[model samples]
Target: MSTGHTSVPEVLDALKDVTYPAGKEQLISAARQAGAGDEVVKALRGMPAEQYAGRAEVARSVRVDPDSDPGTDAGRRAGQARRGGKPGLSQHLREEPRTPIQEEFDR
Candidate 1:
């Protein structure tokens, strides 16, 4: 759920006017030093209108498949090809290592 509000313009305005208690320069400096992504720093430097506009463009550029079929024979074949074996959580772990927190929690 959301706490404060849902207006895009208002959220952008808040992001533009957001102060880090430390300061804008400090925040920007920290963002730079911490190897923050280019998009993040760009959003910080620019105004709300620009940020929102760019975000809108990005959202528009995203290609969402509207014809997905999770139950078709082709879909099942695709799923099996992607999984390559086993299934579910076991398959995920085999492909990628888990974090320490996950290992501890699983135990």
Candidate 2:
């Protein structure tokens, strides 16, 4: 996956004025009107043609570099900040089912 640093931010920044409940064509048009460069426009082009409920969905549709950060989530991607592993590997491998265990333990 490409580093998200250059993708989502640029796209979102270009789309800041866009309203929600937009379609593929609307997004592309808006992005272009907002003076988005080729990279942001190209990312928006890759999205599936459908009605988007909000910016979050649009962000989800756009591919971003998920593993570059070292936090507690998105660890299945490997090299992310995971909490556990065998040896000499990143700790946040996410080998365990995080949601179910956390849910069970929470109550």
lDDT, each prediction: 0.37, 0.68
lDDT of 1: 0.37
Off by over 4 Å in 1: 1-20, 47-107
**lDDT, candidate 1, at 47:** 25
Tens-digit per-residue lDDT, 1-107, candidate 2: 43334467788898899898998889989999999887787777766778888888777676444354455454355433344443322233325445887899999
For all candidates, what are the clash counts? 0, 6
Give all TM-scores, in the order shown: 0.25, 0.56
Which tens-of-lDDT digit does each residue in 22-90 have in candidate 1?
333443455566665454445344322222233343222221221232333555455545756532212
Candidate 2 lowest-lDDT run of ten: 85-94
Q: Clash pairs of candidate 1?
A: none
Could you tell me the TM-score of candidate 2?
0.56
